[model samples]
Each structure stands twice: as structure tokens, then as C-alpha cells.
Target: MFGLPRNRILKKKKDFQAVYSRGKSYANRFLVLYVFRSNGFQGKVGFAAGKKLGNAVKRNRVKRLLRESYRMNQGAIKEGVSLLFVGRKAAVDAGCQDLEKAFLALAKKAGIMAGDVEFSIEKRKNCR
Candidate 1:
């Protein structure tokens, strides 16, 4: 019930390259975003966690965080866009909230968000 569907993912090397070559990039402290407007009229996303980030376990965990964050916020994005969310080394130890904040910020910067929608679910929390 909480899985990102296959159709919503970009699964080809060439597709990833298309976004890499033609898309505009935006970055924040926690993540890197690449956005390309596509004619397919669907919002497809891909994730990248380089080897330099960490071993398989850490990289995979980061990608999982990114995927869930993006999936939760995907509805706010415009149709016909391909987005790549790249994880930074810092994300290996970061919480989901931090990554989600970075994801939303980058989406806004990329100018792909449907509108000025607010993710006011909690705004912030104190776990202390």
C-alpha cells in the first residue's frame, strides 16, 4: 500500500541521461534535484545515490527516504516533468523530515510545483 508504482519511475539509462543532459539542476544542503519538462505528460522520478555516499546499505536507505518523500509530495508537481533526486553524503544520517524539506524546497526552486501548495502537516516537530 505504500509502494511507489512502477509507471511512476524512470527506469532507463537513456531517460536518466535525457534529464541529466537537458534538465535544469537545483541543490540545497541535503539533496540535488534535476528537472526536465517532458512531453509524456506524467510526473516520473528517479533517484541516485552515488557510491561515494556510502556502502550499499546506507545508499539504499537514502534512496528509500527520497522515494517516500517524493511520493508523498509528488501530487504538487506539474505533469510532464522528469525529476531526478540525487542523495548527498549528509543524507546518510539525516532524518526523513530533513530530506523532505530539502525535496520540497528544490521542487519549488525547479518551478515544477503545481502551485504554492503548503505541506503544513506538522511544519515542525520537537522530538526532544
Candidate 2:
């Protein structure tokens, strides 16, 4: 339940270019989200951290945090969209929860998430 399969991940230069060119974007202090909708079954996602963020280690760490944020809440996203998440400089020191909040807020603003969905990744046992 916590897996982001390879098929659902976007990793090609051309693919990233396509999304950037045709997508509508939403941004906040933490992230810039580029969203491109398609007529496919599963939506694809890509994460990016630029050199401005810092050294290689810092960049990769930000990317990993972004990936985990997306992975955990990916179930609430709509199908058939290409989502490119670019991390901002502020994200270098931000934690996963902060990133996740920024991501969901942007998705909500972009109308990319499933309608009226409660974004709870935790599975609570029934008290019955």
C-alpha cells in the first residue's frame, strides 16, 4: 500500500518537458507543481530538485522527502495526469510533513486531486 510502482513514475527528459510545456502550474513557498492531464488510467509523477537548493546530498535528500510525501498521498490524486514537483530552496530544510502539506494544498488549488477526498494515509482500526 506504500509503493510507487515504476510505471507510475515519470523519469524521462522528454516526458518532463511535455508536462512542463503543456501543464498548468501551481506554486507556494515550498513547491512548484506542474500538472498535465491525460486520458490514461494511472497518473504519473516526477520529482525535481535544482542546483540552487544546495550540494548533491542536499538535493537528493529534498527529492527523497518529496517522493515520500507524494507516495503517501498518491491515492487521493486523480488519474491520467502528469505531475512534476519541483522543490524550492525552502524545502531543503523542511520536513516531510511540511512538504506533504504544501503538496496537498497545491493539488487542491490545481483541482488535480480526487473530489472531496479525505487525505488520511493512516489506517485506523475500527473500535467496534
Candidate 3:
């Protein structure tokens, strides 16, 4: 029923801490991305939206948007990596497309995306 399995989600607090401590980070207006190379073949992802963003509903909404953006664009991301996406307060006002753009831009800046491919969200929409 689910495309992304449980293993693909970074669930442990230690894991998040490790990524935060060891990983490199990149940020835009919407989100902050922390990327760390992993030993596994598949990438693992985690999302964070703080209380500062708002109440639980608002935070969850931000998380949902971030997750959807990641799920859609995960194909273009490099394998063997751990990614943590922390949504900013501005993200509460951002749409999915804006979040996706922010995500991809940060991933590219972190050098975790393949350079040979042209990673454009617009092109991806037409292909689908």
C-alpha cells in the first residue's frame, strides 16, 4: 500500500543526531537539508517542523508537504544517503512546488544529486 517502506524512513533519534553532527547542510528560504552519505544502497529520509512553525496541525501540514515533495523527487537524489529536511517558518506559507524547488536546489548545492541529469521539476511533470 505504501511506496516508501518503513526502512526508508529515518526513525531513530540517534540517527537524526548522527546526521546532524556528521552531515553537511544546505538551506534555502523554505527548508534546511542535512545530508550524510550512508553505507546502505537506498536513501533514508527524515522531516522536522518545529513548534515555532505553529500548532500541531500547521507543523504536520508542513511535514506532509515536505514528505510529498521528497517522495516525488526522490528518484533524482543519489543513493546511499541520509537526508533530514527541517522546515522553516516561511515554509508554513510555501506551496508544494516551492518546497520541491527548495529541496532540489539544496540537494544540488550539497552535491548529493547526479550532475549528468537535468533535474527540473517542470520536465518531470510533463513526463508523468
Candidate 4:
């Protein structure tokens, strides 16, 4: 591919809850973001779409796009962190690329990018 990084997929309900409860949030035209510290080795990431977004098909599409974006950009994200990508209703109608952009933008706003090196390293080390 285009030399993108791999995404560690988040799969558990409890992990999603942990992020939702403690993570700080940011919003954009199509997405809302939340991030929280993770327990080392058990750290995971997740995504969620509400019923207000649409039926199952649309909601799943939003989730898929968000997950794919997270996967491609994971290398740039801090490790041992749980991230939650929440989809706005508009996201149901938005193009996949646009939604991906929105997620990344929110990630930056939440200070989860490479520029946040010090915080990330500290967070990761603390979790260990």
C-alpha cells in the first residue's frame, strides 16, 4: 500500500466504555472523538455510531470507515491508549474519505498525534 501503519482493532464492549467515560472529546463536521489512558497490554481502541445516525447498514458503514482510518493512522497515535470515534448523524451521509478526515482532525484536536510525543511516552510508561 501507501506505506500506512496498521491499526490495532478494538473489539470489546468494556474497552469502549472505559474510553467513553474517561476520554476527552472533540467534534468536527462529521465526527466526535474521545480518548483515554489504557491499561498496558490490555489497551485497546474502539468506535461507535448511534441509532440516530441511521439503520444498521449506515451505522456499520460509519464504523467501518472510522476503523479503517484509525488503522491507517495508528502509527501516528500514542500507544497504550483507548480511543473512541463517535459518528455524527451527518456522517451517515458523508463520503468515506470525508469521514476519515474528520476522525483524523479530531485526533489532532485531542492531542493524539506524533507531536504529542512527551505526553504519549509518559502515558505509556505510566501504564506499564
Against the true structure, what is each candidate's TM-score? Answer: 0.88, 0.88, 0.87, 0.76
Superposed model 4: Cα runs more than 4 Å off? 1-8, 40-43, 116-128
lDDT of 1 by residue, 1-128 (tens): 24578987988888888888888899987888998887862578899999999899999999988988887777788888889989998898888888988898888877888977988635433210
Candidate 1 regions exceeding 4 Å error are: 1-3, 121-128
Return the clash pairs for model 1, or none: none
Please state the error at residue 55 of candidate 3 in Å.
0.3
The 10-residue segment of model 1 with minimum total lDDT is 119-128
Query: Among these predicted structures, which one has the highest lDDT?
Result: 2
Cα lDDT for residue 47, candidate 1? 95
Q: How well is each residue in 1-128 modelled by candidate 3, as lDDT tens digits? A: 12667788888898888888888889888999998886852488999999999999999999988988888777777778889999999999887788888887888788887655575565344221
Off by over 4 Å in 2: 40-42, 120-128
Error of 1 at 72 (Å): 0.7
Q: Per-candidate RMSD vs. true structure? A: 3.2, 4.9, 3.5, 9.1
TM-score comparison, 2 vs 3, better candidate:
2
Cα lDDT over the full model 4: 0.69
Write candidate 4's Cα lDDT for 51-117 as tens digits.
9988999899888777766665677777666777888888878765676677767777777787753
